[model samples]
Target: MNSVRNPVLRSFCGWLTALLVVASVAFASGEVRAASFQPLEIVTQSGVQVFSVEIATTEEEKTTGLMYRKELPDGKGMLFDFSPEQQVSMWMKNTYISLDMIFIRADGRILRIAENTEPLSTRIIPSGGLAKGVLEVSAGTAQKYGIRPGDRVAHPLFNGH
Candidate 1:
């Protein structure tokens, strides 16, 4: 009988297994982490920073927007770039995580923040004004990060100043 008791190898194996599980789950769940991640930054008038999110550029991707996920890690979010500023409405219909939807104008200025939306609710969440995008983050993110209408969001989809 051979006993393999190398702690380093055991640790590596455990880590590998965890990675594999996460990858499989993510893959099976349709790559919600993102097909290709992009950096999205939000800066307040007084230099306060809020979010750094991934951009969701396609209709299919935006439609999927964080549905069926058991957890949403901290400091992470999805940006649905709906281009050409228009009225926007969202729902938590198939979504499993409570979210704060931050709507932005064509120029990337925050227009509204729909906070603490109930998970799996069919309620319509609307942007009070024409918006070019919606940033979806874990519930409480808006309050926690001091994000508010008028703040600036930086991304390629916006007319950054």
Candidate 2:
């Protein structure tokens, strides 16, 4: 007798759960803005690619990197400075746009490139080793500009050479 009602209840529950998930994501995606702005560039094999970057130097700033924004223009990014050359990790969390994480050393050389990070994911993206900074750019920026692990990051936090 109870089995007859089970399918209807399950269907209703599924719809409710999906609605809840969508609403949660929508709320989570737009809670913060970039802390500060700076001009940064990468000396890639293709050429010098300039970017308008948001500098995240403090804990609060770093934690808020590019969250809640639905769109990011080309050649723009958020730079997260870890400093002191330590192992670092990043995640998508509330970010709405996929990004390319460019892990940088203190001397301003690119160390690793984690491209096309899934939006809103909480997956831990590590630096693979010690990194002094990270630059988060819109997805496809790395391949589009030929930016690679050995590229040089031109910014005051790095060597800037």
Candidate 3:
């Protein structure tokens, strides 16, 4: 029986080790790029919280609003944008969790808040009046923090749409 070490195999192992080290360093330094979003964190007058929200500004995105998501992170929410402000209606057609939708004007002022919307219900949740943006957070979050019409949504994304 003959035992021999392959140089090619040794080189391959060294290259793999180097690649893994680079990847590890990138991850440790938070330099690893995410292929998808990490959920948005929003703060209202109530406090800081995290939530997973889908942004719906365009006709298409709004059509698919939070259809299949099952979990919602606390303090995180979605900002739906609309160009040329008008009344918007949202429904929990495919949504699996209850949400509180906060309607905001173009200036980021809260116009109306629909809280504790039933999940998977087709009930029409209207924005009441013209609004430029809508934020969806966990159920009852709006009332818990005293978020009401006229309160401003202080986020940089609220420029116009």
The best candidate in terms of TM-score: 2
Of candidate 2, the 10-residue stretch with the lowest lDDT total is 26-35
2 or 3: which has the higher TM-score? 2
The lDDT of each candidate is 0.84, 0.87, 0.71
Error of 1 at 151 (Å): 0.7
- Candidates sorted by TM-score, descending order? 2, 1, 3
* TM-score per model over all chains: 0.77, 0.78, 0.65
Per-residue lDDT, model 3, residue 101, is: 90
RMSD of each: 7.8, 9.5, 9.1
Tens-digit lDDT string for candidate 3 (50-160): 555555556656665666666676666667777567888889987878999988777767889898999999999998998877888889887777677776666544653
Question: Count of backbone clashes for each model?
Answer: 0, 2, 7
Tens digits of per-residue lDDT for model 1 on 38-148? Answer: 777788655655455776777878888888787777788888988889999999988888999999999989999999999999999999999999999999978877888
Worst 10 residues of 1 by lDDT: 44-53
TM-score (C-alpha, index-matched) for candidate 1: 0.77
Which ten residues in a row are the worst by lDDT in model 3?
Answer: 30-39
lDDT (Cα) of model 1: 0.84
